[model samples]
Target chain A: MREFDLLAHVYRSNVDLPADVAIPPGDDMGAIRLGGQTLLVTVDQLADGVHVDLATASLEQVARKAVTRNLSDVAAMAARPVGAVVAVSLPRDFGDTRATELFDSMRRTAAAFDCPLVGGDIAMWDHPLLISVTVFAEPGEVEPVLRSGAQPGDGIYVTGRLGGSNETLPDHYTHHLDFMPRITLARELAGDAATRPSSMIDLSDGLARDLKHLCDAGNLDADLTIADLPLSDGAHQAARRTNEPAWQHALGDGEDYELLFTAPRSPRIETADVPITRIGTMRPCAGATPAILLHLPDGATCKLADLPSLGWEHHA
Target chain B: MREFDLLAHVYRSNVDLPADVAIPPGDDMGAIRLGGQTLLVTVDQLADGVHVDLATASLEQVARKAVTRNLSDVAAMAARPVGAVVAVSLPRDFGDTRATELFDSMRRTAAAFDCPLVGGDIAMWDHPLLISVTVFAEPGEVEPVLRSGAQPGDGIYVTGRLGGSNETLPDHYTHHLDFMPRITLARELAGDAATRPSSMIDLSDGLARDLKHLCDAGNLDADLTIADLPLSDGAHQAARRTNEPAWQHALGDGEDYELLFTAPRSPRIETADVPITRIGTMRPCAGATPAILLHLPDGATCKLADLPSLGWEHHA
Candidate 1:
C-alpha cells in the first residue's frame, strides 16, 4: 500500500508520454521500444543504515547488494541484463581506497551476471554512503511479464526457498546481502509463450507483501497453502530463536530475492538447482475487501492482511 | 586531473567487455551499439550543500539543476535525450510534502528536455539529500563527438558566456541553478560531418579545467586570446567585487553549463540567441610539459597552469 501510494503520487505527471514507452513508471522495470528493440531499465538505491549497516558490511558486500537488487527487478520482468551504471555519494571521510574497492566489487558482480558496469558517477559528500545502480536490459524472445496479468484459476508458484534473509545475523551470513538474483530461473520459466507466467514478482519484501502486490495489481484474491511454502534453514533457526512458527518467518521476514509467479498451470521445468514449488491459487477478487487467505496445514484459515509487518499497514 | 584519475581508478575491471560497447567507461557517456541503434547512457549526482545551498535555493531549483546537469552531458556528446530515471535518498526529517515537490520538480525539468522521468527508487535515510539521475539518449544524425577527437590545428569555440556562475550570489540569483543545457546548440553545431566539432565538452568545471580535459584527451595544447573569450555579466560583477580581472573569472569560476568544443574551421551557423565565439586554436601536444597559453589583451602571455585555480594542482 505504501509503495503503490507513493508511486502514484510521485509519478503523477502532466506531460504527454511518448508512444515508445511500452511500460510506464510504476512497474518493476520501465520498457521502451525503440529501433525494433526493447530496452528495460530499473534503478535501486542502497543506503547505509537503511539497506546495509556499514559497521558489519564491507564495501564489497554493499556494492554486491546494490547491483544484485536491480538485477532482481530485471528478473521480475523476465529480461536479460545488458549493462549498469552506478552513482555514489560517499561520506568525505570514507577514504579513496574504500571507494575504489566498492566500484571494483560492483564491476565484478555485474560481470558475473553478464551485465557489465558501463559507467558511473562518484562524489564525496557529508552524508552516509548511498549507491544507486541503474541497469539496462533487453527483453527475452517472448514478451516480458508484468504484475497485472494474473487471472482466476491461475496456479501461483515460487522459485527456491524464502525467509529469514533479514533475521539471519550478519555474523551468520545473511542471504539478504548475498543471494543470487533469479534471472536465469526467470528465463527458464518465461522462455516460451505457451508456458510463460501470467504475472511475476521478485520477493524483495516478504512473500505476504510481494504476493499482495501482484493480487492488488490484477484485482484478484489468492489462497496460499502454508504446508506447501518452502522455508529456508535460516527461517527455521529464526523461528526457534523467537518462539514463533517457522512458517511465520517464511511468510513475514523479507529479502529472499526469489521469484514468485503465476501460470494457468504450473510448468514442471527441468531445472538443476532452484526448485519450483506451487504454493497457492489465484481467485476472483473479493470485491470491496479483496482478501488474501492463508490456509494453515492444521486446517485453520488466517488473513495475510492480519499478519504483523506484512509490509505496511493493512487497509491503510 | 581529479575527475580523470578517479575515473581510471574506479573503472578498472578484470572482465571481458562486450564488443557492442562503442564508448567505454571514463567518457562523458557510455554508448552501446545494439540492434543497429546506438544507446548513450550517463549518470550524475547532486548533493545538498555541495551542489546547492538549501538555505538559499528551493527544491525546484535543486531538481532543475540535477536534471539539467546530466542533460548537459548528453549535449556534450551531441545526443538526443530520450528518458531518465532518478533515485533519491532523502533525510528522515524531510517531510512527504517536500519529497513530492522534489519529485514533481524533477519530472517537470526532465519533461522540458524531452527526457521523461520513466522510473526511480526512493528511500529515507539520515543523510543530506542526494539525487542520482541517469539519462538514456540516442546520437544525432552524425557520429557523437568525443573529447579525444580534438585534432591539432582545430579552432576552439564555445557556446554562450561563461564564469561567475558560482560566484553570483544566491539572493541576486545564480545561473548555476537555472542555466539551460546546450543540447539544441550541440545539434546545430554537430548536425553535419563537414561542420561538426572534432571534439566537444561541456564546461561544468569552468573553461580552464574542462578545456584542459579536451586537450588532455586528444594529446593537444591550446592557445586562447583573452578578448575573444565571452564573459557573462555575472563574471564582471564578481571581478569588480573581488578585484580580480574579469577574464580571470571567465577562465576559472565553473558551473557555466556551456559547451566548449573544437573544429578544423569555425562553423558560423545561422542561429539566434546563444552566441558562438571562436576563442582559441588547438596545437600539437607539447609532450613533456603541455601548456595552455593565454594571450592577455595587454600584449602579454601567461601559462594557464600558472592561474590560481585552473582546477586541481598544476603539475601534481
Candidate 2:
C-alpha cells in the first residue's frame, strides 16, 4: 500500500514540525532535548498477517520480533536504551492465556535488551492483533548518529548478512523471529568518540530502500558493489527456490533488521561480535542520477530501481 | 470493555519487572531514570468502533483524541512533556486526503501542547483504522507523583467538570473531542514545591473507576460526596435527556479528561484556569471494605458498585 513511503513523504513535506525536534523523521529515530539531555524516541508496529503469520508463529516469537525490530532502530541512532512501552490491540476472542503469553514474552524480550516494558495501553479488536512498541533512549556520552550526517567519500557498511527474513526463511523460530539487534555493537562504536558512525540507518525496508534513505537524507549518492553484498544463507535458499540471484534477495528483501551505516573507516572486526561488511561508498549527489547505483560483478552499472521483481514497495 | 482494568491486572500480577523501573506500571506514566533525569512514558490507542466511530468522526478529530488522551496521561504524572510519536494503521480504502488531514491535525495538536510529534510508524489494515500514540516526559525539578502516593486523610480534588463525554454528549466537536489536557495545572502544581499533589490521576475511565485506581494502588479507601462533585453542564443535559441522575452521569460516564488528584489542601481556585473541586477524602483501608463509598445529599451512604444503571464497566 506504500504506507511507509507515503508517510515519509508527508513528514518531509509537512513544514510545521516544532523547533524542538533535535532529530527529524528521516532517520531511524526522532529526538528532542529535555531535562538537560537528548531523548531519542522511535516506534514500530507489527500487525497480524502483515508482519507475522499468526497461524504459524507463537506469541513469544511475535513479541521478540516486535521488540527487537524497534531496538534495531535504537541501534541505528547509537543511543543507550532508556525503556519502552507496548500498546496492543487484541482480538476480542483472544483469550487470557494468549494474552498472558504475549505480555510475558514482551516483558522478557524487552528486559533482555535492557529496555524494560515500562507502560502500555490495551484494547480489544474484533480481529487482527496489533502491537505498537515505542522505545525511549538517551544519547549517552556521544552525539546521536543521524542519517543526514553522511559525508562524501565515506565507507558504507552494514552489520550481519541480509535477506530472506520475513520471507524465504520465515518460520516459528528462524531469521525473522530471532535475529538479534545491533545495539551492543552500536553502543561500542558510538561510545568512543573516534569510532562513531557519520550516518546510520536500520535496514528494515530492504537495502535498496533503506540505503536510498541515507542517500536522500544526506544528499549523497551511493555506489554499491553487488558482489560484496552480504547475502545470508536464507538469501541463497530463497534464490535457489525462485531461480533468482542471491544478490537480488540481499538487495530487495525487507525486514533484514540489520544496521547500515557510514564511517570514515570500518570498525575493527577483531574486537567485534558480528561481521561488518563494506558494501558501498558515498559521494556528493550526481546532478540527476538515481540515489543509488549498483556496481555488478561483470563491471556493469545500473540504477537500483532498474532491477525488476522487488517483492513489495521497492520503487522510488 | 474492561481492557483498561485487565491491563492493570496483567502489569501487577506479571512479576520480574527489571530493577531500574523508577516508577512502575501502576502510575499514570511508567518512569525510569537515566542521563541524570527521570524519563516518564505512556501510550494509548484508539480504534474504530471502539474508541471512535470513524463514520461520524473526522480523521482530524481522531488524531487529536489519539494525541491529547496520551498527553492527559502525562499530565496525570505531573511531568513536563518532552515529545510524542504517533503510529497509525489506515484502512485500505482510506484515501490519501484523509491521511494528510490526520497527520496535520496530530502535528498541530501535539505541538500546541509543547510535546512535538517527533516520529511514528504507518501501516495499512484491511478495515478499521487504528491509532497508537506514545508520549515521553520528564519530571521537572520535582519527583514524579505516583498513583500509590496517596496518604490517608488527604483531600481528593479534581480539575474541571466531568460526565457525558463519550455517550450523551457525543457531538463532532464537544466533550470527548475537545477537552484540553490539564498539563498547565499539573505543571503549576508539580513545578512548585508546596502545592504538588500527594497522588494524581487523570479522570479518564469515569470518576468511580479512576478513583478506585488511586485507592487500590495507594492501599486506601475514598469517601466521595456526590453533592460536591463538579458535574459538567453536559451531565445535566444528558440526565435531562435520559432518566438518569446527573451525579450518576458524573460518576459513571467516562472519557472525562479532567485531573483527579489528592492533596493536603486544595490548590488556589481563583488563579486557576479550571474549576477545582474537593469531592472526597482518603482514609485507611478498612480490612475488606470496597475501595469507594458514595455519600448522597440525604446522608445515605452506598458503595460505588451499588449504583444501578451505570451504563458500562463500573465495578470493583
Candidate 3:
C-alpha cells in the first residue's frame, strides 16, 4: 500500500477526539482550539530518494521544498503563518557545510513566507536525509477552510496552471521545489465575506487524485470539462518532448502546489497577481460506478477512471 | 561531531527571532506569544536504530516513546499539554497491522497524558521507522521555567532515580518507553510561589550531561555529590550485573526522563507522590577544569570530564 492508502486504512477522525482537537487527521491542516482561538497545524516531510534526488538537487532546494510543502498546506487552509518547527534526520556523513546550507535555506524560506523558524531538532542517522516540518498558523479571520466542506453544485476553481511539476530539477521547467504557496490568494479569498471558498485543498499529488479526494471527503461527485483545464507552458513543452498528450500532464502530473478550491458560486475574477480559472463543478454522488466524470475536448464524456492517471501516484 | 555538537555549532537563537517567539531553541520547549498568552511548542523524534530496537520492542513501546519524549519536554517546561501531532516515516515493508498498532498506541498514549493526538502524517520510504512528535502546550499559570534561570547558589534537585533506562527492553527494567513524565511535579514546583525551581531540565541524556547543560545555559557550574544520588534499583542491579559501579550507571546512563532542577534554596518537598532527591548544588564557574564536578563519598572530587560520557550521544 502507498502512503495515502496506508493512512486511509488506519486513520479515523472524530472517533474519540479530545476536547481541544477541533479538527483531526484527513484534512489539509488540523485545527486545535487554543484560548478560544483556533490554530491550524500540519506536518509534512520530504525524504531523500522518495521526494527528491539529493545528488542532483541542491541542499537549498531540498530544504525549501520541505518548508514550502507545509506552507502549501497552510495556504489550503487559508491560515496566516505563525511559526514552524523542523525535525531533521540526516545521513551520518552529512557535515557542517551541508547542514549550514540546509538550515540557511530553511530559515530563509520560512521567513519569506512569514513563518519563522522557531524551533527544530536535528540528528544524524544512517539513513537518507529526512526533513519533517511542522507549521503552526492562525486560522483565517473567519474559519479555516476544510476539504470536507464542499457542497453539491459548488464551482471548482484552480489557482495557476497545473500539471508537469515533476520536471527534473535544475532545468527550465516549473520546478515544484521552487513553487510558492498561494497564501496571499488564499487569505484574500478566505477574508472576503461575500465569496470565500466552501472547501480548499492544495494540489500536491496532481489534479486527478486531489480532485477525487475533495469529492470523496464531501461525499460528492465532480464533472470537469477537459477543454477548460489550465495547461502550464511547462506541461505543453514536456508533452512535446515526451510525445504525450498535454491533457495527461495537465490532469495527472503532480507537484503543482496550486489551490484547487470549491466555492458555492464562481468567485469573481479580480487581481492578476495570481491566475485563477474555473474548471469544473461538484455534483451529488449519484452512482456507484465513478465519483468523477470527465468531459473531453471533443464533446465526448467518460469516467475519470478511464484516463491514465499520472503525476505522483500513491499506489494501493 | 555529534548531534549536540552540531546543534551547538549551528543553532543560535535570538539571532533573528520573529516578534512573537518568546523563547527559542535550547530551552525545554520554545515559547511563542499567541495573542496575550504564551504557547509552548517542542518537537522530538525517535528513530528505529537510534532510539529503539524494533526487533525487540513492541510497536506500542515505539509509539509510546515518541509521545512520552515530547511530553517530557513539555513537563520540563512545566507547560500544560494542549495537543500533539506526529509524523512517521516507515520502511516500505511496514504493513497495515504495524501501522495500526503504532497509531493506536500513539493515540492512547497521547490521550492518557492529556496531550491528545490532533494530527499526523505518515509516509513509507526505504528506511527504518522514524517518528517525530510535535507537542503544543500552554504555559503554566506562571511563566514557563527556563534552563537559563539557575543561580550559583541554587540547590540542585532531581525527581525520581536516574540510570538503567537503557536496559534492553521487553524485559521489565525501568522501561524509558513507558516512563511517565513529571508534569504534575513540574507544575507543582513551577506554580508554587515559595519553592519554584530556578532552572529545570529533564534528564534524557543522563544526569552528568543534563546537569552540565543546565549549568552551561545558566552560565554556572554544578557540584554533584555521588553519595546523594538516587540510584534506581534497576540501575543498581544492572551495575552489579555488568560489574560497573551503581554511581556510574546513575550518573552516566541516559533516558531516565527524570526532572533535574535547581531551586534558589532547598525547597520543602512534602508530597511523596514522586520521589524527590537533592543531589547537587549550582556554583560559580570558578575552576577552569570542568563545568561539572562530582563529589565522591570518600571526600574526593573530580571533574565530570574525567568520567565516561555514556547515554545518548548525538552525532553530527
Index of the highest-TM-score prediction: 1
The TM-score values for the models, in the order shown, are 0.95, 0.93, 0.95
**Candidate 2 stretches greater than 4 Å from native:** A1-20, A167-173, A192-195, A314-316, B1-19, B167-173, B191-195, B314-316
| Candidates' C-alpha lDDT | 0.83, 0.82, 0.82
Is 1 or 2 the stronger prediction by TM-score?
1
Fnat of all models, as shown: 0.56, 0.62, 0.48
Which consecutive 10 residues in model 3 chain B have the weakest lDDT in total?
B307-316
Per residue, candidate 3 scores C-alpha lDDT tens digits across A193-285 of 667999899998888889998998888999998889988876887797788878778888788899999998767758747888899999999
- Tell me how each candidate scores on DockQ against the true complex: 0.54, 0.53, 0.54
Candidate 2 structure quality by residue, lDDT tens digits, B17-87: 76667776767888887766788888989888888787777777888898999999988988888788888
Higher-scoring candidate on TM-score, 1 or 3: 1
Q: Looking at candidate 2, what TM-score does chain B attain? A: 0.92
Residues B51-166, model 1: lDDT tens digits: 88788888999999989999999999999998999888777788878888888899889988888888888877777888899999998475788988888899999998877886
Ranking by TM-score: 1, 3, 2
Better of 2 and 3 by DockQ: 3
Per-residue CA lDDT of candidate 2, range A123-170, in tens? 877869999999988887767888888898999998999887755354
**Candidate number that wins on DockQ, 1 or 2:** 1
Fnat of model 2, as a fraction: 0.62
